[model samples]
Target: RIAWLKNYAGIDYMVPDPQNPHARVINPVLLNITQGPPNVQPRPRQNLNILDHGQWRHLVVGVTALSHANKPSVTPVKVLSDKITKIYSDIRQFAKIA
Candidate 1:
């Protein structure tokens, strides 16, 4: 996973922090994108050609977190799809209100 991250995700170097031995610190640039409300639709799985590293990471992390949050019953793919639908519905409602 580390090699894949370094090669494909453009994460050059990840080293253990001097102060916190257990914590690893990656290149600052990889942490450029801030956490916030969802701003873009996750790239469709059928379209695996999308080269946006940030979006890919976002989708993977979001899906993983959601799956973990509702574990032991809900499937990961189902959770991700349901979340995507809900996000779109919320966006539409917000737009209507605005």
Candidate 2:
């Protein structure tokens, strides 16, 4: 995965997701969670340098596959300011990114 990302998208060889980690990167939080191996963790994601420049109008995460019980959890991306309460139902669910 690292090789492919480096070759194709040109992502830096450092940690990809600062919040998550894989075999290629060690994360302190993950170590505490599993007490060891990451097999119990979410599926590791290969870095996508193509999305690097922060130019994507929409950031799409997760797979289209039937909600895999073993993959990463669907996280809520903040689409509005914290002060803005009562977001539309559809937007809060991440469906707006679609």
Candidate 3:
């Protein structure tokens, strides 16, 4: 679940705009991880794991006869399987953030 990102994590970046010759080039020093932010609630260790990998979400749909035209002829079990497959495709689209 771990990956390297510019040496460390937490969305670090540096701008090298030469227009400002006197600008600071060094990284900022911060307090140790044990330090607390006075305003925000303390995050759980599970949150750090989320940073390592994107979150997974699942959506499920149950088949019903209301949407079907051949309710009497089509088996409810087969309808459910088709509905589940469509749900999976929807999930894939959602994962793409479209």
Candidate 4:
């Protein structure tokens, strides 16, 4: 996934929504939640050169596929904020360059 991000950074990929489709760049928070190894804590998005720029305009997160049959839990606003914060912070140092 990181490799994919590296190749497509700053490009707005389509997010397939039923009613209204949207576009978003990949981010560490969404990557951790959807693609990280099972049961392992996801790492912070640091040293990732591609993630240093572009503001997130939408909330939709793109995933390769769903692994479980059960529905995902609803995320609280605070936790979601933290995740986004961490992701942005990890890439904050490179915001100017990206």
Candidate 5:
């Protein structure tokens, strides 16, 4: 599961919490529930034809197959904010070199 996330989502670290020795801290952007708009209903499983091949297949399959039941839950808003902050920081760093 950790390897799958690292390979497909570019998430290399799962921070360990000393306070909760059993918990693994993964970025919430990796969750299926955080991937789409809040107002829009998820496409039915029967309609996900795009997952059958190509890059989407790799990502979708890996994410869905991972065992998330034991992971801590995070609000979608928090996930969005974290993702935005990461992107902004990345862009700033890239701009410095280019």
Candidate 6:
């Protein structure tokens, strides 16, 4: 699958907060897709897409928060999809040479 992210200005990324040194963000805003013949139960935490649009937008609070809130979590899926696509392409190339 393919996905995309549209930054219409006023969006920000996660950064280190000096005031709250221990308040680290543990959640990743990406969908972790896994591939295997040995499908494990319960799966890895990284293999799940848990963030909703609202939660995702809240990652960067600002005057343009509404813009973010309306947008879906596309970064993670897009990134993961690109990686998977490259893997498949590599496999295909290998098969052609073999």
Best by the lDDT measure = 1
lDDT of 1 by residue, 1-98 (tens): 44754543324456567789999887454455455565554664455323445655677665455334424376767656665665556556444442
lDDT of each: 0.53, 0.33, 0.38, 0.40, 0.48, 0.38
Better of 4 and 6 by TM-score: 4
Model 3: what TM-score?
Answer: 0.29
TM-score per candidate, chains pooled: 0.31, 0.17, 0.29, 0.27, 0.28, 0.22
| lDDT digits (tens) for residues 65-93 of candidate 4 | 12111123534444445446655676678
**Model 6 weakest 10-residue run by lDDT:** 1-10
Give the lowest summed-lDDT range of ten residues in model 5: 63-72
Q: Which one wins by lDDT: 3 or 6? A: 6
RMSD of candidates 1 onward, in order = 12.9, 15.4, 19.8, 14.7, 12.9, 14.1
Better of 2 and 3 by lDDT: 3
Error of 4 at 42 (Å): 26
Worst 10 residues of 4 by lDDT: 62-71
Q: Which stretches of candidate 2 lie over 4 Å from their true place?
A: 14-56, 59-98
- For model 5, the stretches where C-alpha displacement exceeds 4 angstroms are 1-4, 7-72, 96-98
Which scores higher on lDDT, 5 or 6? 5
Pairs of residues at least 3 apart in sequence or in different chains that clash in candidate 1: none
Q: What is the lDDT of residue 63 in candidate 2?
A: 17
